[model samples]
Target: MSLKRRLELLEKKANYLDSGVKIPQDFKKFNELIGLPISKIPPFKELPIFGYEMDIISNIETHRDYALNKARGIGATEIILRWILFRAVQNKIPGRKFLIVTGIRLGLARDHIKRMINLCYNIPGIIKQSSQYNITINNSEVIAIPANPAAIRGYENVEVIFADEAAHWDLLDDDPVLEAIEPHRTKSNAHVIVVSTPNGRRGFFAKIFHNSESKYYKDVKPWIISEGLLIDRVEVEKVQKEDYYRFEQEYNCQFLTVRYAAFPPEVLAILQSNSMEYQLSD
Candidate 1:
């Protein structure tokens, strides 16, 4: 069947299933309806929903903006990707869009878009058009762009924005990429989801994660050997032996002091706090 005809049938089926009621807003329901593909684990074709994954999904559903400081290899990225797909499928308005801003490398952005296309290909009738950087479903679309100010601007009607590996974005005294996204997000009242492992004690990710007053709903997940699912105890031991700091920052989600900084993180924090207080008093 042609893509259009298949979409028409799918729409009819969806309408029949809902019986004129609003489409279900539950993520788990849609997840079960359209099973997620899992290529990492052999003999398992579908992604399993562990309690951790469910917790993250629940937070995403509840909060308009979320920041996740996740351990490496824990499937945080996978969950966000599936969430974007869920949003795209459930969207009822035309020209509603989703944007994914990946790390410094352009290749990372393309890879994310490719994964979205692959997911759409697995489930028929879900994709209307796809290219190297974007995929269209019905009237809604998902686009992946590089993590730069110029690349992020000019998109409108964005329903959700994902900053993938956000800690690694090339930032200066001010975060231009995040600054660029704010206008689009504010104009559309869009949800912004930032996911990344810790890089250092600085950058936009760290600032948002540590700021208690920020609007972002923040959570951190560490590698728990007792879980014995995503990362194993043996590998953790190896990385710990090689570089304990790397192990702590990467798997344990600790924002440690920079290796060669002139001042300790605590000292800098105190100085910054004092500066702010002085300004307020003056």
Candidate 2:
């Protein structure tokens, strides 16, 4: 039988058996049901869930809006994609939407959608249709697009939105991408998930992570030398010696002073202090 015919039969079977099928509420259970692929190598292996990953998932389950300031090479992205796929498949509401907004490029966003599709391959009747930018599963849809304000404003009924590499989003116009998402997310009451490594001491990601008043449940995980979860301690120490700034910003999760700035933060602070004293002397 053709792939189209096979899908038709699966849909028919799903419609008949849907009432009895139990969707797991816990993400771990759902993940076990459709095992997570560990590698891109053939005869793919199942990913063992890590303690930190489970902590991130627990935060996701508890909080509607979450921000993660993560170090490089952690499995934050993989965990999030699996959770999104789980949500897309289990959603019963018709025409509900999920979105992934990637930094600057539509192609990167589409790649995320593709990963979601790959996750669906083992399961039957979940994926109805898939393209580069969109996937239709049952009555719900998951879409991927660039972090462009005009493009973002066009989506509605969005149940969840993932802002990937959020710190690197173009801030030429003071982050209109986030500005655009705010109204849409507010109107839809959608869960907003922002994940990125530290870019600098700027952008929406940095602001939310630092702001205690922000609603996002923030989680920050750097390279734990004792645990050595994702990155090795020797490699981290090597980088720390080679490029201290890079180590601080990327691995230590510190929002360092922007490299291209005219003066260091201390110099600027001194200048401001001198000007204040000069005004008082006048």
User: Which candidate tops lDDT?
Assistant: 2
RMSD of each: 6.2, 5.4
lDDT tens digits by residue: candidate 1, 1-282: 357746864774575355432334777755554544464656654555677988888898788788899889888887788788888877888999899988567788788888777755535566788888889987798998877777677788889889888887765643787888777757998888888889887888899988889878898888882247666788888999999889999999988877778998789889988886666543
How far out, in Å, is residue 222 in model 1? Answer: 1.3
lDDT string for model 2 (40-106, tens) is 4345544567878888888987887889988887778888999888888788889898889887777
The TM-score of candidate 2 is: 0.84
Which segments of candidate 2 are over 4 A away from where they belong?
Answer: 1-22, 39-45, 225-227, 280-282
Give residue 211's lDDT in candidate 2 (0 to 100): 84
Residue pairs that clash (backbone atoms under 3 angstroms), model 2: none
Candidate 1 lDDT for residue 41? 59
For each candidate in the order shown, give its overall lDDT on alpha carbons. Answer: 0.78, 0.79
